[model samples]
Target: MKTFTKLAFLGIFAATGIIIAGATAAQDAPAKLGDLEVTGAFTKAMLPGQPVGGGYFTIKNNGKSDDMLVSVSSPVAGTVEMHEMAMQGEVMKMRKLDTGIAIPAGKTVELTPGGLHLMFLKVKEPFKQGGKVPVTLSFEKAGKVDITLPVEAAGPGGHEHK
Candidate 1:
C-alpha cells in the first residue's frame, strides 16, 4: 500500500507540470476583436545602439465592412510609425505610411518584413530575445486593442538552427 501511494503521488505531480506548461505556451495565442483576428505578432531582437526596431503581424478581417489600422504605439519606443518598403529605381526605399494600412473585409493583411511593417522610433532600450513588447493598435472602426509582441532572435527563419 505504501509503494502504491508514492507512485500515484508522482503521477499527479507530473500531470500538474504538463498543465502549467501548456498554459504558458498559449500566452502568445491569437487575439480577436469583434470580427478581426490578429496573429503571429512579434519583433526581432535589436543590437545595442540601434535607434529603431521593426514589428510584424497578420490581421484577418471577417466583417462586412472594411477596417483600417490607423496607428500603433509601444511602451518601449518614443513613437511607433506605420511604414512600407518598396523598390525605387533599383534601390530599396523605406517610406512612412501616413494613411495607415487597410484591411479589407473578408480578406487578410500581413505586415511582414520587406513590406508593410511598424517602425519603432527612438527606442528606449534595444529589444532583446525573450522580451515582450506591449503595444496598442488603433483601428478606424474596431476601436483599439492592446497586444504583446514577443521578441525573437535577430536572424531570420521561424526557428534557430544548430
Candidate 2:
C-alpha cells in the first residue's frame, strides 16, 4: 500500500507539470485580432554597426473585406518603413512602399526576405537572437495590432532557432 501511494503521488506531480507547461506555451502562442491572424513574426540578428534590420511576418485575413497594412512602428528603431526588393534589369533595388501592402480577404500575405519586409532604419541597438522586438502594425480595417517579433539568427527560417 505504501509503494502504491508513492507511485500515485509521483504520477500526479508529473501530470501537473505537463499541464502547467502546456498552459504556458499556449499563452505565448500567436495572437488573433478581429478577422486577422498574425503569425510567424520574427527579425534577423543584426551585424555590428549595422544601422538597418528587416522584419518578416505572415498575416492572414479572414474577413470578407480586404485589408491593407498601412505602417509599422517600433521603439527600438528611429524609423520603420515598409520596403520591397525587386530586380530592376541587372541590378537589385529596394524601394519603400508609399501606399503599403494590400492583403486580400481570405488570403495570407507573407512579408519575407528578398520581398516585402519592414525596414528598421537607424536601429537604436542591435537585435540579438532569442529576444523579442515589440512592434505595432497599423491596418486599414483592423486598426492597430501590437505584436512581439521574435529575434532569430540571420537566416531564412521560422522561429524555434537555436
Candidate 3:
C-alpha cells in the first residue's frame, strides 16, 4: 500500500510540474537586441493623415572605439531615412543625409524628436494608438539591432517607465 501511494504521489507531482512550466512558457518573451545595448526608448504619438512618423531610442556603445549607424529599415513604412533638422540660411530645414548617424565609444546616442531620428514616411496603414512597429537598425561595426517602438495616443510627451 505504501508503494502504491508513493507511485501515485510521484505521478501527480510530475504532472503538476509540467503544467506549471507550460503556463509560464505561454507568456511574452524578452526582446533581443543584437550587439548594442538599447535603453530609454519612446515614440511620439502618431496621427492619421500625418505624412511622417518618428522613432526614438538610445543606443549605448559597449565595445572599444566608436561606431556609426548606417541605416534603418522597417516594413511599416515605405522608406526609412536618417534626417536632421538644422538651420540652413534663415530657415530651419529637414535634410536627409546619405551617411548614417554616429555613436561614440562608451557613450549613448539618443534618437528623439527634433533630433536624430528615423523618418518613417509613406506608412502603409494608419498608425493606431497602442500598436507596435518593428524597426531594424544597422550599424557599421555593431551590425544590426532590432527594436520595436510602441505607438501611443497624442500626448504632451512619451510615457516612460523605469
Candidate 4:
C-alpha cells in the first residue's frame, strides 16, 4: 500500500509540472492587441557597461483599418525611441522616427536588425541573457499593451567578457 501511494503521488507531481510548463509556453506566445499579433519580441544580450540596447519584433495587422505604433517605453531605459537605418550615398545613416512606425492594414511590419529597431537610450543596466525586459507599446488606435522581450545571447562582436 505504501509503495502504491508513493507512485501515485509521483505521477501526479509530474503531470502538474507538465501542465504548468504548457501554461508558461502559452503565455510566451504571441501577444495580441485589437486584431494585431505581436511576435518574436526579443532583445540581444548586452555586455556589462554597455550604455544602449536594441529591441526587435514583428507586428501583424489583421484588421481592415491601419494602425500606428506611437511610442515604446521600458523601465530599463530612460527613453526608448524608434529608429531606422538606411544606406544613403554609400554611408549607413540612422535616423529617429519621431512620428513612429506605421502598421498598414493586412500587412506585417518587422522591426529587425540593421533596419527598423528600438533604441534603448540611457539604459540603467545592461540586458543579460535569460532575462526579460518589460515594455509598454502604445498604439494610436489599439491603445497600449504591455509586453516582455526576452534577451537572447549576443553574437560575437570581437569582445570577450570575463
Total backbone collisions for each predicted model = 0, 0, 0, 0
Candidate 3 lDDT, 53-162, residue by residue in tens: 76767787776778898998989899999876544444445567678888888787767554566778887875665777788888897678777777644444333222
Best by lDDT: 4
- Cα error of candidate 4 at position 88, Å: 2.5
The best-first sequence of candidates by TM-score reads: 1, 4, 2, 3
Give candidate 1's TM-score. 0.79
Q: Please report, as a residue range, the 10-residue window in candidate 3 with the lowest summed lDDT.
A: 18-27
User: What are the models' TM-scores?
Assistant: 0.79, 0.76, 0.71, 0.78
For model 1, the superposed segments whose C-alpha errors exceed 4 Å read: 1-27, 159-162
Q: What is the Cα root-mean-square deviation between model 3 and the actual structure?
A: 21.2
Residue lDDT tens for model 4, 1-162: 012243453353243221101111112678899989998777777766566788877899999999999999999999999988655544556688999999999999988665678989998888887889899999999999988888766542322211
Pairs that collide, model 1 = none
Model 1, range 60-127, lDDT digits (tens) per residue? 99999999999999888999999876544444556788888999999998777656788899888988
Question: Which model, 3 or 4, shows the larger TM-score?
Answer: 4
Superposed Cα deviation of residue 54, candidate 1 (Å)? 0.2
Assess the local accuracy of residue 136 in candidate 4 as a C-alpha lDDT between 0 and 100: 92
The global Cα lDDT (0 to 1) of model 2 is 0.71
